[model samples]
Target chain A: MSSEPRIFDPDEHDDVHLETELPEAELSDEAWETAALPDDLLLLGDQLRCDATRLHESHRADRLQHELLRPERAQRAETLVPARGISAWLPLLWLLPVVLITAALVSNGQPTVPRIPASPAVAVTPSVTPQAEYSPQVYSVSLPAETPSQHGPSAAELDALLDLMQNETASVAVSL
Target chain B: MKICGLDVEKLTSLYFDRIHRAALLMSGNAWDADDLAQEVFLIVANDPTKFEGRSSHYTYLYGILLNLERRLRRKRRMHQEKTEKLAQRQDGPTAAVAADVPVVSEEWKRSLWSVAAELPDGQRQAIVLRFGEELPYQEIADILGCPLGTVKSRIFHGLGTLRKLVAESPGQLREIPRELGDAQSDVI
Candidate 1:
C-alpha cells in the first residue's frame, strides 16, 4: 500500500521495477510468435491454392464453353389452324379472287363485270347521265336485246316502257 | 489506336485484379466481390479504346471502382437498413443485435472477425481495407469513398475496440506490440 516512488540511487544493486506497470502475462522474455509456416508447407499451400483457383477457373471456363456451344433452339413458324369449317375458306376463296381480279384489272386498265342495280330489273331508269339507283357503273354493261327481252319486259310493254323512259330522260335533263 | 494499347490492356488487367481484391476484402465474401468486380470492369472495358492514357490506368480504374463501390455499398446499406428497420418495428433493440452477427465461431480469427463485424459498417470496411488488405490510408479512403481523416478515424477506433475486447478476455493483457498497443492506448 506504500505510495513512495522506488529509489535507484548510487550503490543500489536492487533490480529495476519492471513488474510495477507491466502486466504479468506480457512480461515474459519470449515474444508471442505466429506459428512459423514450414517451407514445404508453404509451398504446398501455395500449390493447393493455385490448383483450387485453376479448378475454379476451369469450371467457369467449362460453363462458358458449354453455353457458347449449346445449340440454340430453332424458331419454328407457327402454323395457324382455323377453328371454323369450310365457311372460312369460302370467304377467303371468294374475296381473294375478287380482290386479285380487281387489282389486276385496275393495273391493266381493264374493267370487271358491272354490278347490277338494286331495282326490279324492269323499271330501268332512262337518265342520259346514267342515274343508277344503286351503282354508278352498273348500267354501262349494255345488255343484248335478246337477253333484255328474255329477262326484261314483254314487247307490248316495251313501247309503253320506251315512252316512259323518254319522258324520264327529258325530266332528268331539265332538272340538270 | 489509343495509348500503348497492349500495355494499357495489361495495366487494365492489373487494375481489375487490384480493384477486385480490394472489393473482396471490403465485402468479406467472394460472390458479392466477383459481381462488384464484374460491374467495375464493365464500366472500364466500355470504350477501352477511348482511354487516352493521360493518367495511370490503375488510377482511372480505381476511380471508377470507387464510384461503383460507393453506389453498391449504398444500395446494400439501404437493403440492410430496411431489414433492420423492419426488424426493429417487430422486435425493438434485439433486432439490432440480431442483425449484427450472422455467424458464430470460437476461433481467434472468428472472434476478431465478429468484433470487426460488429463495428459500424464504415469502420468495418476501413479496417478490412487497412488491416485485412494492408492498404495505405489514402488508398483505403479512396476505396471506401471517404475522406482521409474519416479513414484514419475508423481504423483507429476499430483497432481500439478490438484491443479492448482482447484485453477483457482470460488473464492479464499479453505483449501486444508497442506500436499497436500505443494506438489502442492513445484512443482510450
Candidate 2:
C-alpha cells in the first residue's frame, strides 16, 4: 500500500538544462532584496518581512482534524442552503393569497360580479322668490320763486354810520 | 489518515506550517487560508491517486492549495458580483491580524499582501513559493510546473508588480489588476 510519489530527480528532467540556459529568469532571495527600491518601498519590504517572520515562527494544523472528520455533504448542506427564512416560506407565501381568496369565496357562497350601485340622481331646485322690479323714480329740481337776493348794507341800513357821515359833526367821535 | 502510501496525516503534521503560511500569503485572511489549507488536504485524502510519485510532496500539496485558492478567489468574485447590490458588499479576505507585526506596519503589510493576492496565477505561485514559503528557485519551479528560469522570470515580474503596487498604494485597498486578475479564473 506504499504508493509514495517518486521523488523528482533533476537528472531525469530537461528543466535542469533549461535552468542554466535562462539565468535571467531566476531571482534569489538575496538578489530580490538587493534589487533597488525607493526608500518608502524599502521600509515597506522590511515591514512585510516582519509579517512573514511572524507567520514563519508559528504553525498548527488547526482545522485538519475537523476537515477530515466532517462529512462533505454536511458542509455543503450548511452553505448550499437554497432556502432559508423567507425563501423556505416563499412557496407557501405565493399560495397564501389564493388560498385565502378561495376560502372566502367558498364561505361567502358563489362568486358574484359585484353590481355597480346607480350613481345618486342629482336633484334640481327652482329659486322660489322672483326678482323684484327695480325702477328708479325720476327726480325733479325747482328754483324758489325768488331766491332771496342777498343785499349789501345801505346807508339807511347803517343808520348810525350814515348819520355820522351826514352830520360830519362827530367826525372825531364816529370814525366811519 | 494513511491512504495508500500517502500518509496524509503525517504529511499534514509535516508541512502544515508551510502550506498554511502559503495559504495565508495567497489569501490575506487567516480564516480563508485555514479553510484553503484544510481543503487541500481533504482533496488529496479523497483522491490519493491524483498525486502520483512525480514531484516533491510539498509541491503536490502547494499545487492543490493554489488550485483551491484560485477557485475560492473566483467563487468569491462571482459571489461578489451576484450580491454586489445587496445593500452590503460581500465579505472579502480580511486578515486584520494576519501577523503579529507592528501596528504601524500592519496597514502596509496588509496592503502588500492583498496586492500580492491579486497577482496572476503563475506569477503569484512563483512569488509565494519564493518569498512566502522561502522555497528555493528549483523548488518553486517544481511546484509551479515551470523551468527554473521561467520561475525566476515570474518571480522577477511578480515582485516588480508588488514593489510598484506597494510603492504607489501602500495603505489603501488597491484595485485588482484587470488584465491579469481574471486570467486564471478558469484555472481550477
Candidate 3:
C-alpha cells in the first residue's frame, strides 16, 4: 500500500449544490465515488476509529467504577472537619518560625549592652611606668635631649650614669 | 425542566458519551480523560449562559476540552525539558546527546494506536476527531478554532504518517484481514 495520502480537492465539490439539497441517495454513482475517500484509506481510518472507540469504552467503564466507589457526601463532610489534638495545630505551626525571625530582626536593630566609652589615653599612660623596668634600656639610653617630655628618665640623667660607669672601669684597669 | 439553569439530564443523555470519548482521544489516557470530561461539564453547569448557542453544544464543549488539553500538553513538555536539563547537568554533556536508535518497526506492528499516540498534538487531535469521533471537517475546524483548510491538512498529514508507520512492518499487513473484520464491527 502506498503511504501517500490521496488529497481530496475542495474545488471538485464546489460545483455541487448544498449538502442538504443532495442527499446520498440523490447522488449519481460517479459523483459519490468522487466525493468519498479511497477504500484503502477508509479502511485504515476505520481501524483507527475502532481502536479509539475501544479506548473510550474502557475509559468510560473505569470512570463509572470510580464514581461508584467515590466517597459519599457524609464521608466528604467528615474530611472537612478540623483534625484533633496536635494535628489540629499543624497548620498554625508554620507561623512559629516566621514570628521568631521577625522578632529577632526587630531586636537586632537596637544595642542590647551599653557601650562604655574607651578609657582616656592619659589614664593609660600612668599605668605604663610600672612596666618600664621590663622595657629595653637601649631605647631609653638612645633618647635625644630634644625628645618630648613624658614619665621616663631624662636624657641628662642617662648621660650622668654613663660617666660614672666609665670612671669605675678605668680605675680597675690601672690597678691590674 | 433544568437542574442548574441547563437541562442536566438532557445534556448528559445527548452529549456525555461523545464528549467523554473526545476527551479520551485528546488526553490519550483514561485518568486525564475523566478529569477533562468532568471539567468540561462543570464549566457548562456552572454557567449555562456561556453556551451562547452560536454553535452546537458539542462544539462548545469540545472547544473547552481542546483548550485544556493544549495547556496540559505544554506543561508536560516544559516538565520533560526541565527533567532532561537536570539529567544533563548531573551526568555531563554526554548524557544530553541524542541517541541514534532507529524506530522499531515491530512496535508499530504490535499496535497502530502507539504510532497514533506519537504523532504531533495537532495531527493526533485531527486524526482522533476525524476518525475516532467521526466529526465533520467544519465542526472540527470550529472546535479547534482553525480554518477549514487547516483541519483538512492536518487529517491528510496525520493519515499519511499512520500509513507510513504501518508500511514499516509489511508482515503486519498480511494480518489485516482478521483485524479489518474486527475494526469494522467496532467502528459501525
Candidate 4:
C-alpha cells in the first residue's frame, strides 16, 4: 500500500486560495553567513547534558546501593520475634500452668470427700480417784444476784462484737 | 546539566551546531535560542525518560525543546504583552528611523527567522524537519505522529508564509503592507 496522502484542492468547494510566495532577496553573502551559526552553542548543551546524565546515573547507583544496604525496620521487626523454637511455644507455656491447675482442681472435685478421723485416747487408772461418797467437798458460790454478772454474751453483745470486726476489716474483704 | 547517552564534552565539540540550529528553528531569537538549547540539555539530563526511544536521540531532544518552547511561550505571553505595551508607551513618541542605518546584512536572516517564528506550529515543525534537519517526509510524519499530507501541507504553508514575509518586508519587490504582515492573515 502507498503511504502518500492524497492531495485534494479544497478551493473548488470552499472558495479558498493557495498562493506560493517567493523570497524577495537573492541570497546575500552576509545573509548566508548570518544564517550559519556557531557550532559550539549547539553542542555545548548536549555535552553538559551528557555530563549531567553521568552524574545522575552515578547518584542513582549510589541511591540504589543505599536502599539495598540500608538497615530496615524489618530487621527490628525480626528482633521483636523471640529466638528459637522456645519462642514459638511461649504462649502455650504460659497456658500450661493454668491448664494443670484447672485440671487438678476439676479432678479433685470428681473424687468423694474423705471422712474426718475420730479422736483416739487410751484408758487411764482410777486409783486415788475421789468417790461420790467423799461428797467431792462440793460448795456453790453464786455471783451476786443483784449485781450484773458477765455471762454468755447477750444478742446485743454479740452484735457489738460483729460490728467491731466489720469496722476493722478492709473494704476489699467486705466486697468479697 | 547533563544529557544521558550524549557525552557533554564531546557533544560540546561535535553537536552544538545541531542543538543550536534546532533551538533557533524552534525559537526565533538567538539569545532565546541558546537558552532554549541549554534548557533542553538540562531537561534531558534531569529526566532522560522524556526522550523515550521513539526517535533518534537528537530528534527526541528536539521534541523536548519544542515542547519546552511552547510551555515557555504560554507562560510569558501575558507578561510579554504587558511589557511590550509598556515599552511601546515609553518609546513610541521618540521612535524614529535612524538616519544612518547599520548592519542591513542580517536583516534578511532576522526577518526570515521572525517569519518562521510567526508560522503555525504544525507548519513550522514541518519546515524545521524538512529544511533544518533535512528529514524525509515520512520521517517527519513519524516524528510528528501525523499523516503524511499534514506534514506536506505544513512545509508548503510554512515556506509560503516565510516567502511572503520576506517579499513583503520594507525594500521588497511586493507591496507587502503592515496589514498583510499581520499574523492573522489566513493561510494563503
- Pairs with backbone N, CA or C atoms under 3 Å apart (clashes), candidate 4: A42-B16, A42-B20, A43-B15, A43-B16, A47-B8, A49-B2, A49-B3, A50-B3, A52-B2, B2-B45
Pairs that clash in candidate 1: none
**Candidate 4 CAPRI level:** incorrect
Per-model tally of clashing residue pairs: 0, 5, 0, 10
Q: Backbone clash tally for model 4?
A: 10
Give the candidates in order of TM-score, highest first.
3, 2, 4, 1
CA deviation > 4 Å runs, candidate 2: A1-20, A24-47, A55-176, B1-6, B85-111, B170-188
Q: How does each model score on lDDT?
A: 0.52, 0.64, 0.65, 0.55
- The two-chain DockQ for each candidate, comma-separated, is 0.01, 0.09, 0.10, 0.01
Model 3 chain B scores worst on lDDT over the 10 consecutive residues at B179-188
lDDT of 2 by residue, A5-120 (tens): 97877775574465456534345546643553333333444545665666544323435656676898677887887645656656788888899999898868964667688998
Deviation from native of the Cα of residue B26 in model 4, angstroms: 4.4
Runs of candidate 4 with Cα error greater than 4 angstroms are A1-176, B1-14, B25-29, B84-111, B172-188
Best by DockQ: 3
> What docking grade does candidate 1 earn?
incorrect
lDDT of 2 by residue, B118-188 (tens): 67888777767766676877787777776666776665566656656654675453432323331211101
| Over 4 Å off, model 3 | A1-39, A60-176, B1-13, B92-111, B167-188
Q: What tens-digit string does per-residue lDDT give for candidate 3 at B63-127?
A: 88877877877886676677677777788664443332223223232445666766788888887
